[model samples]
Target: MTPSNQRCSVAIIGGGAAGITAAAVLRKRAPQLSVTIVEPSSTHDYQPAWTLVGAGEYDVATTRRRLKAVLPAGVSLIQQRAHSFEPTSNRVQLEDGSILEYEQLIVAAGLQTNWQLIDGLVDTLGKNGVCSNYSYDTAPYTWECVQGMQNGRALFTQPPMPIKCPGAPQKILYMAADHFKRKGRKVELGFCNAGPAIFGVPFYAKALMQVVKHYGIATHFGYNLVAVNGPGKEAVFETTVDGMKIRHIEKFDMLHVTPPQSAPDFIKNSPLADAAGFVAVNKHSLQSTLFPNVFALGDCAGTANSKTAAAVRAQAPIMVSNLLALRMGSALSAQYDGYASCPLTTSVGKIILAEFGYDGVVMPSFAADPRKPARRYWHLKKRFLPWLYWNQMLMGNTGPDWHAKREYPDTLPSISP
Candidate 1:
């Protein structure tokens, strides 16, 4: 069905955290501009809480809301999938063969999870002791699998880099291990990571090694999950040994898989995409390198920052401010410092609040040593963060800027049990 030409002052490409927050901020700050969001989903999800949900600590239903309920009152919404982008004409093509023109475009469309990349995974994802926390439907099954297992090898696999919430794959591993410990179940846990290190930041990684040692988890670096024989209760992993590809198969009582991810196809095929298929934006300004009138943030943006919702919270305001400056014919003064936070859930009542900025500089919001796991951070993660996300962040309120680069010793802190 073809429709007449539609135009707006600004068009947002996704209704996720970045798009919704940007729209709310624009409406509050620049009420005169006509904003329209192009999104097909009927519900908005607070995905950060999914880790807790998978661990049986949170309810999955509470993480979702009707899309209309969260959107600001004045903004317009187009409930259709975006098929393509015509940046040269400032137009976006919808899946239904309609064109929407705009004076400015914001590509906040998030990345896509490639579940089918692993062979035989789709056929046995939610059953046969294989589950994942990446999806709302599968997350509950993760807890189910953990509870049903009495004692056996429970393998957790992390795909290559660039997945949203990079710590999520291991977060559930720690949670499951903690659950087993509390229940007096003797379950063997293993972490199969494609990356060489457990975490990106050396400061946090050093701390995490202590936790791993405490749990006695076998760490398999450079190993990537390639296939799952669910009925057979086996998983295949591949690794490179001196430029040669080697495959290893292991038996498991349960498996948690974090699939590979990439930018959505529509954005990847567009001219706005960088070589790696993410929106090419200046790291500091969050403005598209190709089109001055275009901007991008969140997981889709080609930036060095860790892809987390905390990154979205920091990027949205800067993107909105810089975008507004561009519209007003002023200098883009707002800058993003690549700040992101990860509350590593070491156990049910403990967390290591890992915060950092560009170049992996340790940034701590509190005075205590950031490497130490504490119960306070756990409460912050399980109680305060969800409220901050839904009530404050989604309402366009950028909270206090407490996180900053702080000086700490280069050596690792003493390991504790």
Candidate 2:
């Protein structure tokens, strides 16, 4: 087959955390290897800070920066959307009818936020008290909705599992509840979770449940939001019990919706994906099982780890080390332990930093008991982490060494073998 387009030594499919980190590391470690980043966005967002932004504690502007500013020197940026992958020819097809050939491919294009999955959601989002922190555009509106409400029914909904930052859906709820309490507002707050549990890990779940009780939030397990009528201030939910599906309608004065998410359609439909539509890769190595030269990280990879930026931070180095080693015809020694961290902000001044790996093994980074809420953790979440993300992580100066050694069982079977 004939091809017409540009060529590079390495072509990264995304400019997000994973792609940027990989590029930064490659630039530093392998200077002669030409690199080009294909991304559609002009700005990069530090999404972890959006929870605080929604709570009116942090300014939204600080969470975003020009993508050019963060990218490493000597790395090329192609500000275009990738339409498809041609692995056999080692080429990527762009939306603008351009093709890029590469010696190796790294797919870090994060998940897609499917707001359209919920009926009437797209038209009403960021208006009529319907807000979502999942978006940079709508997050500020969440603060607006939170500020104007004196006290009524506030519903925070969590869609199914595998969403990025699983704790974020509830973290914002805690922020809103704390805000309402401080203002002496009488509000009926409800947390509608599509999943059956409060938290995935039991150690952290106990502490979170206490915070949930303190806020007097009614919990609805197995409830999934299916539709929203923003003008009417009504929401529709679906649930299953004993193999029977049920529908429930609830009225809300305010709604914070975490829309459903999945791997981007281009990656899902490509030959790189598994049955689940994620790029099929060896969970530990981050290398594509189908294609040796292809690697994936962040939300789009079918890894068993929680889809947090922390997971990507832990994953980037290993992916790069192994990738470079493969290029040198050396043995690949890097293996990811499925590390992920979730800073569960219990309140404004307190947080329970939940760090764990495969199979929910409690991995605490500090000497203090991770089960209890600590103000120090709050400081780390509010101030330190954002700085680290911008200065160290995206620049490829960080690794999983900061992750706390798992204090739990050694013999426990991990989610992956």
Regions of model 1 farther than 4 Å from truth: 414-417
Candidate 1: how many backbone clashes?
0
Model 2 per-residue lDDT tens digits across residues 50-82: 999998888999999999999999999999999
Give the Cα error of residue 357 in candidate 2, in Å.
0.8
Q: Pick the candidate with the highest lDDT.
A: 1
* Per-candidate local distance difference test: 0.92, 0.90
Error of 1 at 205 (Å): 0.4
- TM-score of predicted structure 2: 0.95
> What tens-digit string does per-residue lDDT give for candidate 1 at 11-59?
9999999899889888888999999999999999999898999899999
Model 2 segments more than 4 A misplaced: 1-4, 408-417
TM-score against truth, every candidate: 0.98, 0.95
